[model samples]
Target: MKQSPATPLPSPKERRRLREAGSLTQAQVAERVGVTREMVRAWESGRTNPRGRKREVYAKLLGTLAEEEEPRRPEVTEPQETLVEPAPPAPPLTPAQAFDALYAFCAPALVRQAYLLTGRRELARESVERAFQLAWQRWPEVAVDRDPAGWVRATAYEYALSPWHRFRPRYRHPEAPPADASDRALMAVLLRLPTPQRRTLVLYDGVGLDLPETAAETEASTPAAAGRLMNAREAIAARLPELSDPAELHRRLTELAATERLRAAKPPVVRTGSERRARFWTRAAIAFTVALIGTTALTVRTAPTHYEPPIAPGAEIQGVPERVAQGPLSEAEVDLREKLRGEMTSGPVRLTPLSR
Candidate 1:
C-alpha cells in the first residue's frame, strides 16, 4: 500500500501554544512521540526540528493538536487573495567596513581590560592594537566568529599578561601609579594576584561573563575558574576591605580602567598598519627563501663530485749507508809516514817517489 501523505505542522510558537492549550506537558508529548523531552523542547524552541520518521510523527501529532486547539471560523465569500509586499534586503557590509565596525566597538573596551591586566597605559594600548592587528590579519576567521569581541579580548589579555614583556627595556620598570591613593592600592592588589586568577576575576566580575563563559575564555575548567575568582576576590578584599562586594569591586574596576585616558588608534590606521606588517613579513619570508635557494644552488655547483683520498705524509727510510768517520793523526804518526816516504826502501818506491 502507498504511504499516506505527511502532515504539516505550524510554526514553533504556534506548536507550543497548541500543546499548552491542550494542557499537555513536554514530557507527555515526548512520551507519545517516542523521543526525549529535551528533543521536544528543542523543537518547540526552534533550536532543532525533528527529521525522518520522527518528523512525520511529530508533524502529525502537532497537526492534530493544532486542529483541536484552533477555533473553526464561518466561511466568508470574498476575494481571499491578498498582495503582500516583500521586505527589502539589507545592504551587505564590505569586509573592511565590517572589520572597522568590530574594531571601533571592541577596541576601547579591550584597551581598558588590558590596562587592568597590565596596569601600564602604553602596554594596554599596544595590547589592544596588537590584538586588533592580529584580528585584521585573520579577518576571515574573526569575522565569522560567534563572539568577535571576546576573541579580541582574549588576544589582548594574552598579550598584556605575557611574561616576556618584563624582559623588554621599556616595560622593565612599572608605570606610574594612579594619582588617587585608593586606585593605587587597588592596582597593587590586582597586580599581586596570579595571572589566571586576575583574568578570571576580571572576566567574571568586571566583564560580567558567566562562570562557564569565563572558564571557556580563560581555557580553564569551571571549578578552576571558580577557584580563581574566589581567590582573587579574597586577595583583593584582604587588601581593600571596602571592595568585598563583587558589584562594588566591579564598579571600582570600571573606575580604575577609566582613570587613564587610554584611547585606541583609528580603525583605518590599525587596518593599514596590519596590512603593512603583513606585507613586510611576506617580503622578508620571500627574500629569505630566495637566499636559501641561491645558497643551495651555489653549494651544489661547487661541490666535489667524487671523494679524493688525502696524500700520506713522508717517512724516514731504514737501510741507507752512513759516512765512515776518520780520526786525526798524532805528531809521531806524521813523522813516521814522512821518514818512510823519504827512505823509499821498497822496489815500487822508485816509481812512486817522484810523484810524492
Candidate 2:
C-alpha cells in the first residue's frame, strides 16, 4: 500500500522548544519514539531528520505538545457569576535572597558531582563552597547568566579536577572508598580515567545533560567529547562487565555518588566569607598602592639634581730620583765643588778691591 506523505514539522528550534515546554527530557522523548537519545538530539539540532515510523510518532508527539501548549480561552458564559480581585504580584527578590535560593538549590547536587569527580568527600564540599564563593563575589555576572547553575557547576568541576589539588597537604592522601566492594571498585576505575574523559562522563551520564551541552561545559568539541565519553565507558566496562550497558553505568554512577553524604555551607556563611575575602584583598591592594606612592615620592625628594665629576686618585711621579743618605763625597765631586767656589771668588776680587 502506498503511504501518505510525511507530516510537516516545525523548525529545529521549534521542535526543541515544544519538547522543553512539555517538560520532557530528550531521553524520555527518545524512549517514547523508539530511538536513541543521540537520534533525538540530532533531530532537534537539524543535523538529520527522522524517517518512516519514527517520523510519524515524533510529529504526532510534537502536535500533542503544541496543543497542550496553546492557551484556551475561558467560556464567556462562565463570567456572569461573581466579581473576583486579582492577586498582587510578589515583591522582587533581593540579591542576597536570589543568591541564597540558587545556592540552596544547586549546592547539594554540586557536592555530589564534585565527589564523583574527586572521590573525596571533604574536597567535594570544599569545591562547591569555593565555587559558590566565587559566584557570590561575581553576583552581578552570575545573576544575569543564562544558566547560573551551569556556571557554578563548571567552576566546581574545574576545581575538583584540578591537578594542583594533589599537591595540597590534606589532599595528598586519597580518601577512603565507599563501604561496598562494588562501589570501591567503581570509584577506583573512575579515578583512573583522565580528567577530561571523567568530566565528560560525569556531565553526560551522571548529570543527564545532552551531548552538546556536555561538550560545552567540558570545553571540548562535540566530537572530542563523544570520543572521551566512549573511551571512558569502554574503560569502565572493561573493569566491571556488569556496567557495560550505558543505563546500568548511569545507575551505578548515581549510586556511587549517593553513597557520599556531602553537604555545603549555608548561603549566609558563603556570602559572608566571600565578602570577607573580597574586602581583605581590596584592603591589601590599597595599602600596597599607598606604600608604592609614598616610596616613589620619597625617592624623588631625596634624589640628586645635578651631576658632579668624581676626583681622580693620586699617583706617584714617573722618573723621580730616590733620596740617599750623604756619605763621604768622591774625590772628583769634592775637587769640582772647590774649583767652582774659587773661580767665583777670583772673578769678584778685582771689583771688590776698589770699593774697599
**Which structure among the candidates has the greatest lDDT?**
2
What Cα-based lDDT does every candidate model obtain?
0.88, 0.90
Query: How does model 1 score by TM-score?
Result: 0.66
TM-score of each: 0.66, 0.71
Residue 207 local lDDT, model 1: 70
Per-residue lDDT of 160-199 in model 1, one digit per residue for the tens? 9999998999999988999999999999999999999999
lDDT (Cα, 0-100) at 51 in candidate 2 = 82
Which regions of candidate 2 fall more than 4 Å away from where they truly are?
Answer: 1-28, 34-81, 309-356
After superposition, which runs of candidate 1 have C-alpha atoms over 4 Å from their true positions?
1-87, 310-356
Model 1 has a clash total of 0
Q: Write the per-residue lDDT of candidate 2 for residues 252-319, one digit (tens) a residue.
A: 98888887777788999999999999999999999999999999999999998998888989987898
